[model samples]
Target: MPRSIRYFVAPAAMALSMCATAVVAQSFSSSTFEIPKPERQTFVPAGTSCGSIVLTQSTSQSITAANSVSCNAGGLHSDNSYFRSFPLAADINVCEVQFGIETATGASGTQPVTVNLYSGTGAFPGTFPGSYTQIGTASLNVPDQAATIFPATVSGLATAGSNLVVEVFTPDGQTAGNSFFIGSNASGESAPSYLQAADCGVTSPATTGSIGFPGMNIVMNVVGNPGGPSLSVGSAQATLVDQCASNPGQANGVIEPGETVTVQVPISAAGGSFTGVVATLGIPAPAGITYVNSTSNIGSLADGNSATATFTVTADAGATCVTGFSLPINVTSNEGATASGSVASQIGESG
Candidate 1:
């Protein structure tokens, strides 16, 4: 899992008639923590249609943690095509697609990136050649800019689920391994980025993770309309992590004093952009439960858009344990107007 930006509040002393003696609030994270890089990748096939994922990564995979300079894709001297699957809920006519560039490698000039999109039935890799049918293709030259978006033209109507498969490559226009690299971040994309090429050792659909880079993702994003994209809940299944770490007694699958509960809310904003995105638990914690970190900053949403707001809830000694708890959360963004939605999570049974 990835780390979230946290805000910690100090413990304050409140006299419970000056008699209770000791009791305090606390703070915690979903886990240790790393920059949350969210991305969307489906599957990549052989050939150089769109820009291939960089082969010989400039930055070592060993150092590919969040904020690592070495992009999950992009290599020092490898030529390969990169691909990812996007499953959006709206019906869209993709007019263009953007391939984020991390580094131009050694592209003094003449680094051409050809991108393509395929409409497919069934799931990717699982369906492969039989599922994906070419939609359209576009190309662009790699710019000198260090980090930015390079776009390609692709036309198609994407539906829900396994809608579209995107591809990028460095055809014959530029040196195979000496062109540019695709940009990626630790924002937390659900799909996997796929690559294809001989120099990269992958002749077919293989994840950057499979080849060594575990969490590498090519920021292959979409720019389409017709059915203008919107942001909504993708997955809101909130649960507890390391119950023992927060739980005071036996991990009896029930909410007990000192137990830490994690509420992870994942949202996908394919073509929807939201600002000042924030998430908070809608329902107040039952008696004895302290919402250590109740709200999380989702920040902004854009082309390569997705975010997971993780909140921490704890059960104090005074908590009232009952049946499993159902937590409702609200995700709101101010886009000129306030747009918000509520989601419920079955965190745990109150003991």
Candidate 2:
């Protein structure tokens, strides 16, 4: 059996109180706590794409006239095709992609941009055959004469230990001398940028260049789950009983000295499945509270499943002076994931 581990931090302690029966006035309150979710990983090489030399001409015009003529042909410019290669630390489902681009003042236009993710083979500018998959594309509107980020949504799976290639295609060729450029970082750190121009074309052996200086401003958003199961606490309830004869008719939130409080917490599991769940209560001895039953077994939970645990607390006859108190509850899974939550209430003393 594969071993898994999960860690959860329960919410802050809830307030509960036990006082004389004479103190019948009290109020109940509820608040929610946030559970940590799996974090998204981002890849950003050291560089910016503003003010870098033009690499490939995305427009359809020939490479020589690409800079002079606006290849407004409305498709990938044979002159400018760009790609970046990087490695994945773990298996991830890619969710988003962003690119930095520059446009001349008053050169606003909308075009559909295509992005592809490929499994790499060989070297830096790996051989991207027809086997590559077209993840998704976005229709972006460029702002004239300004530096802006173009964001797109793409979905694909990249396995760990594989070199991933991200390719970007520009829409339509632009008019001659009309300036539009892809951003790049000057530092060729991390992934090397490759260019396939009309002159060199994608078919010719690709040449490595730092065109979009700092390197191309490309970002990849990856969705992945942290190891093990994830756990969280839901709504909680407790039974209140006044053991002290002095506080006979106290409300749910109020208890007299020698009263007993029973708390029930709801637990849930997400992200993965696990077995042997247990819940325990942690009360400070100095708080004048005793745990009648400190632990409960929850058994097993499949992913997206839920269960509840109950605990009993008794107030010491001599427990006094404190108007309110709190206790910590911890829930653990045999697989190693743990979650915590608390219950609390206010107390008033009666004559």
Candidate 3:
């Protein structure tokens, strides 16, 4: 994955620089918004050419703006614009936008493109509240054989369930023969349909409305603290394999005197709240089973994260046979929360 983080603090503020960097690193996350191909067809202006706009599943998860319409003049003001809305599940600091451009055939020239973020008023392709900011810009050259990813750093705060309109603008002043399309994917689908302006100029005017395309995939990377950390542990299992046996295949939930068994468990964190988690296996000494360094340290975890821990147990050579022995597992976090579970281990003579 191509991961990138952007700090919103200004460079002149030296005192808060380190703190900002740390918070930004911890808050890094991403989301991809996508939509399926539309049942109807739509058209959009690309410089001097008009292209049929439709969502295609064949080209990965991206929407295709096929530039087929051509114009006689090359220098005319032929502006093209495409817009998509992204809904946030929780409050987040918008950081980056990643996209790609594909040009099959067209004049060889540089196409000036700009990406902007706007707060939607309401409904699909809702009204822009005039509170919009330009996040980034790029100059795309013609004859791009492969899909090229363009990543831009954007700084803004959005409320939960809020719609953030992402607009891509291809202005005039470039070669009219320069015809191409923007690439998108259907990895993550969400609300608020994709919109575009066919013959509209550099900016997406208020009059521009929603198109036939409902879902278009445009990936957005954001950073935020969802909530306090949560933790969980998967089921624990024990493995016993005779070292001297020819096959030495592993046995489940069974062990013998003087033999060793390994227990494995998986731990996870939800809401990214807890840090410095540790797992320990608690076995009574009187049971004749020794805990040989059976502790796993899981440094830290963010929300929706996970880790694994393993424990080793050894049975005494002269120990009495035990059936269905219960071994306790204790997982503690620095945040003052502890989770407990148990696994069964059996020690008996095998024919």
Best by TM-score: 1
Candidate 3 positional error at 304, Å: 28
Could you give candidate 2's per-residue lDDT for residues 1-351 as a string of tens digits?
A: 563322211112211222564212111111111112211122232111111111221211111101111112221232355566656565544433455443323234443456665654345454465444443333333444223334443334455676656666653343432334454333233445565444222342243433222223332222223323456543223335443456556544454567776667656665567788898887563277788989989889876555777777777777774457766777788899776656565444554
Q: Please give the lDDT score for candidate 1.
A: 0.51
* Superposition error at 85 for model 3 (Å): 1.0
* lDDT at position 200, candidate 3: 26
lDDT of 1 at 332: 67
lDDT of 1 by residue, 187-280 (tens): 4556677766553245577776665554455665565544444444422123345346544465554555556766565554534567887777
lDDT of all predictions: 0.51, 0.45, 0.45
Which residue runs of candidate 3 sit more than 4 Å off their true CA positions?
1-77, 104-109, 129-145, 173-177, 184-189, 198-351
lDDT of 3 by residue, 256-323 (tens): 77777676766655434577799887756437787775798987866544567777778778877864
Where's the lowest-lDDT run of ten residues in candidate 3?
45-54
Candidates ranked, most accurate by TM-score first? 1, 2, 3
Q: Which ten residues in a row have the lowest lDDT in candidate 1?
A: 23-32
Candidate 3 versus truth, CA RMSD in Å, comes to 20.5
Q: Candidate 1 at 154: error in angstroms?
A: 3.2
In candidate 3, position 139 carries an lDDT of 34
